[model samples]
Every structure is written in structure tokens, then in C-alpha cells.
Target: MTYFKVLFFTLCFLAFTTHAKEQPLKLDKHLSVFQPYLGSWQADFDVAPGTKPVQDVGLWERALNGKAIRTKHSINEGEYGGESMIFYDSKKDSLVFYYFTTAGFYTKGTIKVLSPTQFVAYEEVTGSKEGITKVKSTSDLKDGKLVVSTSYLKKGEWTKPESRIYTRSNQAVKFK
Candidate 1:
């Protein structure tokens, strides 16, 4: 009887271990990538001379059937950025990005996360001096700073996009 009991317990443990290993990753279908982005952000931009350097404030949230992340960014240098969508598609396992800017640009792309703190999204421009536009966004905690990036691109024969890094400079006020 003791031998049979030990055998049953061992089998049960092995079954549980196997099941845990095969568990599917869970994604919040109701949460767009934007939900993770909701918060105050500080931006430091690199600008050319004769053009004053720029910095800004921004807000983000989820939208569109809980399928996209949207951002509304404002600058102190007399320019305003409009809302944009960042969608995560589980079927293709990629982040679909789309944005229409008042500055006269409509761009789209897919985002691949290389790590929890690093990702790059890119697609092409369709009209009027067409080129591939890529944006690399990376975030990390450093001395409690929240950093992100929206890198620029000038596609010439499919060159890779550059990276942008943003660091949190102020105390984060939770709005949950």
C-alpha cells in the first residue's frame, strides 16, 4: 500500500510540472499597448543649431476596441503633436502602429519587442517622396527615471532605424 501511494504522488507531481511548463502566455485582450503608456513623460530632443532645443509633456491611453495605444504629446517650443495609435496583434504576434499627424504625415508599422524594455516599430510612407519611416522606442528604469524613445528614419534602400531613449525625470504621479 505504501509503495502504491508513493507511486501515485510522484505521478501527480510530474503531471503538474509538465502542465506548468506548457501554459500559454496570457495577454490582456482589453488592454491596448497604450494603457501601459498612461503617465506623464519628459522628452529631450536633439535639434540643429539656429533651432532651439525642444522638450515636452504627453498623455497616453488605450483605444479602438482595446486594440491600440494612443499618445497626445505637447511641446514647449510652439509645436503640438497629435494622438496616435499603437496596436498589438496576437495573431501575427506584432504591434501594429498607425499615426496621422497635423504636421502632414501618415505613417504605419509593426513593432517587435526584443526585450521587456526594448522595441522597434517600422513601416513605409506611401506618397510624396516615399521612404520607410522607422521608430525605435526603449524604456528603462534608472534612478527611478522612466525612459522611452521615438527615433527618426530616412529610408534609403532599407536601412535600419536608429534608437531613441527617454528617461523619467520627475516623480510619477499614479492615476489608476
Candidate 2:
């Protein structure tokens, strides 16, 4: 074939091959979410009408030497703060969180990837039958603000819904 035609075909082939090799970005590592949520946070939330008062809780390091983040959760004017669970799930691309408050209640849940910076954790039931408990929690960053929304689900549908807004205050702590 002509030299010009051969060169054109080669260029086209190279362009297609190069573009095909480029893949979309995904949550490949835990650090992608951990680096942003490692520090302190105050969550404003509610339980039931005659339940405990609405609160803003302070979160901080409860321990230094560990693989997990040990946080102390405090109220606006209360001395007692809830200590909670903080860790990342590498395989699931999610974050695990837990808390037991002064009202003597235990809660645990997760935040899962819906996108790179956005996540929502829905209720999950584990066990064959007879014995099971529900989980309710979710969070995401939107419009330069981190918004957390929660709900109770039965058989994978929302039963009760609530939401809270949080802003990233401190610079994210980083480590290599």
C-alpha cells in the first residue's frame, strides 16, 4: 500500500490501543478514605422523641499505639464521652464504626463506596435464621461538606431516616 495510507493506519491503531488500556479510577486502597476521616468530628443526631437529648460529640485519640483509631466522643457540656470503633476495610472498600453512649446503647455500622469520595452503609443481616439484628448508618462528602445520613432497614429497605451535616475542620493527618 502507499506510505501515506500505511502511516495513517499505524497512527489509528496506536490511538485505539492507548485509549483501551486506560481504566477508570476506583477505591483500590484504604488510605484513600482513612486519611480524610482520621481526625476529630462532632455529630449532631437524634434517637426518639422522649430519648436522650440531641448532641454534638467531640472525637479524639483515646490510644496512641494501635492499628485502629481509638476515639473519645464527648457531649457539649457533659464530661462523659463515648469511646468508639474506627477502622478501614481494605477488601470491601469501606470504613467500620461503632459506639456505646451514656444512655447504655450499642451501635455499629459501616460506610461503603458509592463513588470515590461518596459512601453509604446500609443495614445488613447475618445468620441463617431466628437470630439477627439490624444496622443503620451512612455518610458522604458533597458540595465541599461531609453529610451523614442514617436509617433503619428491614429486608433492605429504609424504615426510619435521619441526617446530619459535618464540615472538615482540621487538616487531615497523614503517614507513610
Query: Which one wins on lDDT?
Result: 2
Clash count per candidate: 3, 0
Model 2 segments more than 4 A misplaced: 1-31, 43-55, 60-66, 79-81, 88-97, 122-133, 153-158, 168-176
Model 1, residue 33: what's the lDDT? 29
Instruction: Supply the TM-score for candidate 1.
Output: 0.56
lDDT of 1 by residue, 1-176 (tens): 99999999999999999998993433355342233455566666777888987776566554554556676666663375545677666787777767765466667777766554445556555442445454445554345355554445556443443333455435332221
- Per TM-score, the best of the predicted structures is 1
Q: What are the per-residue Cα lDDT tens digits for candidate 2 across 1-176?
A: 69999999999999999999986333325434534454566655656788776555554452333335565555554544556665676676567767655544555767666776677764444441423256566667667566776665555555666688765444222211
* Candidate 1 clashing pairs, residues 3+ apart or interchain: 146-168, 147-166, 148-166
Find the number of clashing residue pairs for candidate 2. 0
